[model samples]
Every structure is written in structure tokens, then in C-alpha cells.
Target: MVELSQTLLNLPVLICRLRGDVVQVETWISASGKHGHTGDWLVRDYITGETHLRATSSRYLMIDKKTRKLSFLKEAWADQIKPHVLDCHEYPIIMGDNRKLLQILDVDTADYVRTGLSPLWNDLDINQYVNYHIKYISWILEGAPRSFLESHKLSAMTVEYRKECGRESMLHNLSAVSRNGTSATNSTDHFTEDEGIEFDHSLYLQDGSEVLRARTMWMPKSI
Candidate 1:
């Protein structure tokens, strides 16, 4: 009975810390219609009801960090688009009064994508997906932020994240086994070594129903 309500669908906003400024990027479409990367790629902006198109590409997987070269099939510009945070709340949002809302919440975009959907569930049909998406968007606009934040589900969100990670790991292992057969262990080891795919095991706890304010990347950490 868990549906993807808008309060749960994190905005599909992408941002990168470049030259000391946080810059946002729209998911791009290609001319041939066969190439692109849409991270947690939603067709419409849940908050603003703006529509976007998603495309597919294997090229994004081949991008090199040093080059940061955007694909030649990039719909508009030829400039290199580097890897960026998959989702960000810092994205530009034009309010009805033409004012800008300036909250930039940073979270693991992949984690955000997994928030609403359970690993074992299927879409059932197109209408079901659309209906759930609409409900999610509606909640984002009309739901009470204070009540949602103070709800017991807010505290349980981390547990869901852990379940998501477990599902992902299980799927990955299954894929590895299917692809490599007898060499599955070797392939998995290679994947772990090459990708540094470590799971975050830390727990998140809030003492009370008190909400915390946003904090941009103000602290320095060693790379």
C-alpha cells in the first residue's frame, strides 16, 4: 500500500560543484532520440508540473572523469557535461510570484529514487504508474511540510534506505552470477575492487520532531 506520494519523490534536480559555485543541469534529450542520461529521470517536474523528455544512451557509461566530455549527441550544447549529483534541492525554482525558493538540500540521488518504489513491486500497468506519480506530485504541492517531517515515517525512512541497499546488492549479485556463471565470485570481486562499491552502514537519528535547516557543502573533507 506504499505509494509514491510527492512528499516522497525527491525532485529530479541535478547539480555540480564547479569553480566553487553550485550549478544545475537539466536532463538533456538527443536529436536521434537514442542517447542521453536522465538520473531518476522524471518526465515532469513534480513541484512545478513542468514536463521533460527522457532518452537512453550507453555513452554516458563511457564518460571519463578527466575529459568531462559531453556526448556529441547531447541535444543542444557541445560543451562537456561532467558527472554531477543526480538530485539536488538547490535547483532553481520559479515561484508563482516570480520569486525564487532558495533551499538546496543535498542527498544521494539514487537513494532518493528508491524512496517510493519497493524492490519487489511491479508497476502492474501504465495507469497505476501515472496515478501514483500524480498523487506524489500533488502531495509535494499541497501537503503540510511540518506534519510530514514530524511523522513517524520520517524516522523510519532510513530503514527503508537500508532495505533498498540490500535489494540492490542482491540484484547485483544475481546479475553477476548470471553473467559469469562459474566465475561469478571472481566477477563480483572485480566489481568491488574497481567500483569501490561500499555500502553506507551508518544510522541516522533525530532526537525530536524538530526540523533541521538546510546546510550546503560548507565543510571541507579530504578526497
Candidate 2:
């Protein structure tokens, strides 16, 4: 059942009905993986019953959170039968492991999260591209002001803004040592950018290289 269900996910289930934003998926449990378990699924577009997307191997799984186990149902799965979520989404949702793409490509990324704008990975100006990385950073750190960032860019920029923020997620893996000198951060964008946090970050390069640096300074008396 699980294997059969796995194939169903690979098949593009028809979006037969969409009300509000929910999408209905008409997936199937094929006849014992005849077509191709991770290979193919019989799907007809709901709008015209026209076959649009074909498939071979795909990624999908069902997990039972409470038990910390997975439920591989050979049927179907969709948060919204109507798939409405995609309609009003602010960020672009791509399938597959995007992390792998970033890793393989070795795209150089930097995060100068500060009161100043954080850099956008997509909008790498020649200077930023040339330098280890440079550009006013986009202010989309997880807790950074969301509405504030939204205000700068149109709603459409949310995805870009988020991608901009994610450009440096891998940096956390490095050690954040105690600050004894002036190589510490004090982001004007984040008034508390250095309020009391024990952190000094590194930059993630598009070339999959990291430029490590320290940020330190004497506590300023004036704002």
C-alpha cells in the first residue's frame, strides 16, 4: 500500500475542483505498481481531463507525528482539495530539495542582517557578486520586522525577501565565539542587533564558500 501510494504522489493528480483556494486531487493506487511506483501515475487534468504533467520518480511521504512514524498511504494527499493555498501565496514553492541545489551550485551568499537592508541573493549587484558579497542586505531575518520588510517591497517580493534571508542559514553551523575585540555586529536595522546576543556571523558564498569574520566593538554610550 505504501509503495503504491508513493507512486500516486509522483503522478500529477488532477485539480478537478478549486473552490476558494483548495485543490482537489484525484490520485490513485495503481494496480501493484504496474505503470511505475516512483515512475508514473495516471492523472487527467480536471479542467479539460487533459494530461499535462507526466512523471517517473518523485518524492513524497506520510508521517504520523505522534508516533514519530511515517504513514505511506498509496492513495493521495493534499492540504486543500482546491489547492487554494497556491493562489494567495506570497512565496514561490518549488518542489524537491532546494537545499541540494544551493549546495551543488555553491552559490555564494552573505547575511549582513542589520537595521540596514539585507542583500537579496537574486539581486546580486556586480559589486556584491565580485566582493565575497556586497549589497544592502534585505531585512528579513526570521524575527526581523515582517511588516517592515513587506512595506519596502511589494507583496510580490515576499518570496524574494525570504530567499534573501535564507541565503545564509548554513552559517549557524560555524562556531559563535565570545567577543573580545571589535569584530562584532551592531545592526542599525536591528536596534538590538547587538543588544546582548553572543554572536558574530560568517557569510555564505554563492560558490559554496564561506568568508568568516568577526564583529566587535566597545559599548557605545550614545545612540
- List all candidate RMSDs to the true structure: 19.9, 19.6
Candidate 2 lDDT over 1-223, as tens digits, reads 2211121112122222335433223333212222222223334455556654433333334434344245654334343222422232222112332222121112133223322223356654332321222231221122223443243221111111011223333332122323322344465344343332222333343443543232212222221
Error of 2 at 44 (Å): 23
lDDT scores in order? 0.23, 0.28
Candidate 1 structure quality by residue, lDDT tens digits, 90-205: 22231121012222222331122112222233422332222243322222222223342232121101000111111211111000001111132663354322221111111111
Clashes of each: 3, 42
The lDDT of model 2 is: 0.28
Off by over 4 Å in 2: 1-60, 74-99, 102-151, 154-223
TM-score of 1: 0.17
Worst 10 residues of 1 by lDDT: 155-164
Best by TM-score: 2
- lDDT, residue 220, candidate 1: 12
| Per-candidate TM-score against the hidden true structure | 0.17, 0.20
Compared with the true structure, model 2 gives a TM-score of 0.20
